[model samples]
Target: MSLAERLVRLPDPRRRRGVRHPFVAVLLIAASAVAAGARSYAAIGQWARSAPQQTLARLGARLLTSLNVRIAPSGSTIRRIVSTVCPGGLADLMGEAPTGAPAVAVDGKSARGSRTDTALAAHLLSAVTATGRVVSQLRVPDKTNEISTFTALLAPFDLTGTVVTADALHTQREHAKWLVEVKKAHYLLVVKCNQPNLHAAVRALPWQEVTARRYDRGRGHGRRETRSVRTLTVTGLGLDFPHVVQAVKILRHRTNVKSGKVTRQIVYAITDMTAREASPQFIGRIARSQWGIEAVHHVRDTTFAEDASQIRTGYGPENMATLRNLAINRLREHGHTSIAAGLREMSYEPFTRPLDLLGVAP
Candidate 1:
């Protein structure tokens, strides 16, 4: 079946009037609002009312025979209908992933302004793919951590044959065990201060004692900076750690010029992959992927103006953030030459017209 047909087949809770056309209208409005950079209900209403009536005419072909195409839904009416449907139901309709995807990263972000006089700040956990699509998400109270929300967020999707990665905050023994033992998925987690013994042992490895050396250099600001990294892989270290197949030490030395003076800094990382499984190139790539969460957050905050959204109601902030994610993924899927260019094009006047530029019909 076609994309619209698959979408309409998904469950929606708001069936009060036995009219399906209005429901499809609301879905179309929501999709267009996200494409045009309307992140909240109010902005969506404004866009819907301001849109030319012809913009929705195509949806008539998709409606059931019993439903009339002449009927139009008011902004408030669409909002109420949309708000009544469960977020998970809507996400299912939007396509999480096709089969055979490799990895899914779980991370959390706090909506900086979504706090109330009586409620705690809103925190969200999103399961995003490696190519930067948010597959699914869940919201938790401010007092809880990502671990508290991980299982619930992961419950709805298939996890077999996929690798789950997260920052050190979620590198708990139980979390790792659950991903490996319960979910039957491999895990690549960052080791940090939270696991004191693992951190110390990985830090104390005989990196200096090993005989391996690698150096890389690049130019910036008309000056040259050189970095040297050495790796030492040790097995049978007599360290008891959970889900740790092998331990490694990475020593990085950087020399840069600041105000005509040179400076240096060192950093390290610990992983569950063995030296055999994780070559120098492999480790470097994985380390870089850790910043995927940062990229998602940066786009949401700056390009989408997420910080400026004043949605501070019950679950409103979290839900709007999810919409922003949906918008980002949809834009990425449509093959924008670059995300910045995509955002700039969407920010222009008559934003809806640019859908044709991206090969998407209204």
Candidate 2:
């Protein structure tokens, strides 16, 4: 079925008199606006007002049948509907991969300046895939730790057969134990200053004392460098927390060309998976892929102009963010060579035609 159809199938939370079915019209409007570069409500409203009839017809329904343009609802209405639904429901709609360990990365982003009265930002926790698909998201109450948000965000999904990765902020003992003991999923989390004992042990270990390999090279007006990392499973680190199967120290080196410059970067990671369960190379790759959240954030903020959005109040901000994610995932699923290019193409034409976007026949 089409994305529009699937979206329409989502349960509606409105009980007001003017409430309409969860028609694809609004979703189509939102998607087209996103594609055409309408990042804010006013811009989308303007786009909808410009060609009301055409847009409505494309959605297979008409909100404002008269004058070919109907009055669009206030942005507040949109936001309210978005916030009512559970984000996990939307995640399930994105589907899943058939094979291989599903790489799931959890990270948080702050919508700075989203609130008017105070400087308090909206902290959003998102679960995304390696290819930058946002599976789900949650809005944490201000003053709460990400650990509190992490468990709730993970509750709805099946972590089995999945490899969950997160940064040091989410590397709590309980978090690791929950993912393994409760969810039966493997976890790859970074160990940083926050975990004092774990951090000190990872640091105090005879790291350089262990045999390691270093690789380096040079390029245009600059030099290049690489370090082949290896790790030996060590026990008795005296960690106060539980479920820490092993600790790993990753050594990295870099060189500059224009000027003969040398730099070294070292990282430490902790995981419940042991050497018998996971190899050093596997750990390295998982740790590296944790940055997928960065790429996802970059695309949402830069390509989609999420940070520049002026949406505030009610559900507008959250709903719009979800729409951007939906648009991104759809474009990626279709094998679009470039998300920016795909969005641009969708903006100039009709959006109700899901088959066209999916490169399928009607």
Candidate 3:
């Protein structure tokens, strides 16, 4: 379905009285404005005002029959709609993860600008696909952490046949069992010091004796890094962890091409899939998928200016983040790797090219 039609699914938080714009129109304008590089409500309002009458009409802008004039929703109205809309619904409507079998990465990010003296910044746990599309996100309530909100963040989607990848924070025995047994999905969870027994057991594996099963090198941004992955089957072993089929150890070495500095780090991960089901290289690749969400976080901050946004009223922060995700995901899907450049192309003089991305029929 078109994003405009999908937006109608968002719960209307406004009452019927004094509603100046169509619900879909208001949201469509907000989304279009953001896609055309509007960062905040003020920018959205300005973009709406400068928009052509026909553009507004196609975006569902209301027509004043008395004067035959089409006017955009006011900034305050847009702010109200954005701040009250359901974030989860918005994320899904903005091109969510495909249900078949893509690898999904779970991570959390904090909107630093939302922090106040009385309350901490809003931290959201997000599930992002391998291609950097944010499929699901939920706020971690004040005084709570992602670990507690993990299940709730993933509750909305059908994840069967999905390989869920996450850091050590989500390595709980119950979570693993739920993903494997209940959700009918697989988990590739990193092992860390937080889970002492699992961490020690993974560390004690005869990794030195097992040759590295996978090798890789990365060169970019003034540094070169090499990595190797070694896998060992531990299903028959008397491990305390749930449904452990393979234990993986990844060792990474980084050398600063400019400074001649070298650094090394190692990480271990456990997956429910047996070696036959998932090769050692596949395990390493899926484990690396966690960076997709990290890249999303970076793009939000650097490209979309998410960390700098001061929107903290109601659901404003999360809603704006979802809009940013929409912009980036749409551009990426259309083969625009440079989000900033794609947004520049979107902000054309006619202000109509970005509408094509929204599936607006000419």
Candidate 4:
């Protein structure tokens, strides 16, 4: 029923002998420390060591040291265990969306700190729900890009009736066909130069004559922006896009309140849903939800300082990223608006709060 119970179900990747700390306890402790704002192995170990005996007991951390006292795993041990644990299994356990037609926004991010002069940074593709929950995440291979990894990122979920949104990079006909035919899901994919014919066709539509339209205006972060969306039934458009039933064009006009500078851009997209299935208003909301993945990535970079971390060794980067996602989701679920503030509160004395969040057992 608790997170630790679910975590204990994962197979330990370590050897059978000479293990002091229970593998489940080590994993639970690491995840709890990360949720409490420990950004690195050293910080995680420090948090474990500084935890009160009651908190450690709740986390199932009863490993005894030479001094004949129960203790947490050392920094090196925590690092090794995390690095070797199965990332996909961990993600599958931590990432689960609520039932219904959830809006899934897929996006990719590169960890700047993991890059070297000779090698590119670790690129990860993530599927995030509209409510800012991570549904899944997978690392793109060193030899490939997001487009190549997009389908795999989506393969784990049973996406029936779900709306999966992605940027222009994943607007290929193959992706559309796969989503519609194989997954039985709908797609709201951005059209751009990547799909030249599809882009031109959607752009050339008589959007002004479309019967369905929606407009919205908002001010935030020192800028005022207006968005106008036009939707047209694609049945008569004579476009060759796969399973396309509607085409959309969104025009955004922005003005910087501080600089008085103005800019405008138009975005095109094709969706499997008909004009009736996805009204103009619903389209507008779903389009905005496409940025949810960006919000998740932004928090990891800014709040957790993920881009500044120097952890690049063996599964370390991906493993750390998984824990960071879990932490962010937990904080948001617990009604913490600001991740940094949540970390500070959890990091205060008597560290039992983190254990409580982790559903640790007494």
Per residue, candidate 1 scores C-alpha lDDT tens digits across 1-362 of 43356557656656556664556556666666666777678777787666654565644323334864344466666566565556665665564662455677788887877766877667777777877778877777567777888888776777876767788788777777777778777667766777888778777887767655456666654456665555555546765555666544444433445555566655455445566666665555444455576788888887777777777765467656766776677678778735666756675843455344333355
For candidate 4, lDDT tens digit of each residue in 235-317? Answer: 97699988999998999999999999999999998899987789888888999889667878889998899999988877788
For candidate 1, the lDDT comes to 0.64
Query: Deviation in angstroms for 258 in model 1?
Result: 9.0
In order, how many clashes per candidate? 0, 8, 0, 0
| Preferred candidate (TM-score higher): 3 or 4 | 3
Number of the top-ranking candidate, with TM-score as the measure:
3
Q: Ten residues in a row with the worst lDDT in model 1?
A: 350-359
Mind giving the per-residue lDDT tens digits that candidate 3 earns over 31-114?
A: 888999999999999989888998998997999999999988889989999999887777767757658746999999999998
- lDDT, each prediction: 0.64, 0.67, 0.86, 0.85
User: Which candidate do you rate higher for lDDT, 2 or 3?
Assistant: 3
Which digits, one per residue and each the tens of the lDDT, describe model 2 over residues 115-225? 678645677788887776777777777788678889888787777867799989987878888988898888877788988877887778777666532333324325676
User: Which residues of candidate 2, in runs, are more than 4 Å off?
Assistant: 20-24, 50-55, 63-101, 209-228, 236-240, 254-263, 348-355, 358-362
Deviating ranges (above 4 Å) for candidate 1: 1-3, 15-21, 60-72, 92-99, 210-235, 248-269, 347-362
| lDDT-based ranking | 3, 4, 2, 1
